[model samples]
Target: MGRMDDRSVIVTGAGRGIGRAIAERLAAEGAAVAVTDVDEDTATGTAAEIGGKAVGIHADVTDPGSVRAMVQRAREEFGRIDGLVNNAGWDKIGPFVDSDPADWDRIIRINLYGVLHTSQAVVPVMIAQGGGTVVNIASDAARVGSSGEAVYSAAKGGVISFTKTLAREVARHGINANCVCPGPTDTPLFSSLFEGNDRLRDALVKAIPFRRLARPDDLAATVAFFASPDATYLTGQTVSVSGGLSMV
Candidate 1:
């Protein structure tokens, strides 16, 4: 049996990239996974690809109603939610001084408020069920700050703080909340940010002690650990999977 045998997990933005990797890992570890995404096709497609006790639900993380519906759907399919991975996020690259407030609003909505919406809808279920684990995907940018990602960093920093506070409040209910911060990951989002800028990508790779960008699986493994029985005693903590790029 896998580490997550018989557990049920909901992973947001699970159509591609890191989210997809997390879903795949959880499913492989014997967890029934709810793979949610804004795009219905991609969500269902990913669920089909994972091929197990996995279901896909379309959910807009930025919307409370949508998040609630997604949670309801997961509960209907899996009977109970034993884990939640808030992995949905978006970002745009530009100097903070040059960034538009609208963009900042969008970033905050997806990266920070999304976490709030999901946790609010799902935590009560966990409490009712006696226990659950929350693995929030924050960012190394939030911990160390990154150029051209000021607003994203601020939003993710709020996630880290919110997660810690949630952990404290929900520990009495047997809920564990923690944050995972990934750095310079090799995903479509990362590629989009550095399109035609190979020099910057190369420089970043050289800067990391690992001499490479973090694979989605790297982040996935850590998230799985958080969701598994291995992390029952861990809560209100933030882990950085940055290949030694940020050591704080």
Candidate 2:
């Protein structure tokens, strides 16, 4: 049997990139997955690709009402809530002082507030079900402070702190909370940050210790480990899956 046989999981932004990889990995491990995205078509497409144990739900994680509905839909379709992967995030690349306030607000709403909304909506279900896991997809920028990623890093930094506090608060209830910090990765979601410029991408990749950009599967594997039984004893920590890019 697979590691997550019969388990129910929710993976946000699962229409593509790392989120899609995570959803696919969990499904391969026998989990019934609820794949969520703001774009309904891609979300459903991903669910179909993963097989019958998955369903697609369209949601805006930045909106509390939408998140509540997403959680409810997951419970209704899967019968239980075993895990939540907060992998949906947004950002704009620029110096901290150079960024517009509006950009900061937009990034924070999706990157930080979205975590809050989803976790709050799902925790009650997880608690009643006896236990659950939360894996927030943070960024290496949160740890090492990347240039041009000030707000994004700050928002993810808050998520790291939030992971620890939430873990402490819910350990008694059997819920695990943690984060995975990915380095510069090759995901469609990252397209915006690089502006579709191959030269810039090459420069970024050369800087990494691995001499290549991280793939979505790399992030997915790390997240899968966190959700697996092997990680039951682990909580409140951040695993840097950055190919030794940010070792601090």
Candidate 3:
């Protein structure tokens, strides 16, 4: 049997890039995934491509009401939510002194508050079902400060702390929580960060011990592992999938 046979999962921001990779990986392992994104077309397309019990749903992570409706739809479609991957996030790269307050607000809303809304929505479902797993997609910046990602790093740091606290609170219910920190992954988001700067990209690649940036699949594999039965005894942990970039 597949690792996630009969499991139902929600992967937010799953339209493309890292989120898409995670959803596709989980589906390949036999889980029915709810591929959700703010963009309905891409979300639906991804769901169609997965072509099983998967469903595409619209969810604006920054908005709790939208998140609630999305979670409700998943529960209605799948009967139960066995897993939740908080993969929705956004960032603006620049020095803190040069950053605008609006940028900070956006970063906090999508990266941090987004987790809060989704986790709060999913935990109840998991509780009623007796147990579940939460694999949060944080960033290596949170562990070791990134030069251009001050607010983003702070938001992700919050995620790590929140995951640990949530893990402690939910362990009694058999639920587990963990964080996966990806460093310089070759996703659209990564590309956007270095839009016209191939030098920056090349320098980053050379710095990684693997001599390359991480692939979305790398993070996907870690996330899947945490969601699997193999990681039943693991919780409140933070793992970095950065090709040995930051060993903290």
Backbone atom clashes (below 3 Å) for every candidate? 0, 0, 0
How many residue-pair clashes does candidate 2 contain? 0
TM-score of 3: 0.99
Q: State the lDDT at 38 in candidate 3.
A: 95
- What do the candidate models score in CA lDDT, each in turn? 0.97, 0.91, 0.96
| TM-score against native, each model | 0.99, 0.97, 0.99
Candidates in descending TM-score order = 1, 3, 2
Query: Tell me, what's the RMSD of every candidate?
Result: 0.5, 1.1, 0.6
Question: What are the per-residue Cα lDDT tens digits for candidate 3 across 1-248?
Answer: 78999999999999999999999999999999999999999999999998888899999999999999999999999999999999999998898999999999999999999999999999999999999999999999999999989999999999999999999999999999999999999988889889999998899899999999999999999999999888989999999999999998
Q: Candidate 2 or 3, higher TM-score?
A: 3
Using lDDT as the measure, name the better of candidate 1 and candidate 3. 1
Question: Candidate 1, which ten residues in sequence have the lowest lDDT sum?
Answer: 69-78
**For residues 1-248, could you state the per-residue lDDT of candidate 2 as single tens digits?**
99999788999999999999999999988889999998999999999989869999998999999889888898889889999999998888877887799998999999999999999999888899889999998889999898888989999999999999999999999999999999988887677778868898888888888898889999999999998877998999899988888787
Model 2 TM-score on a 0 to 1 scale:
0.97
- Candidate 3 has which clashing residue pairs, if any? none
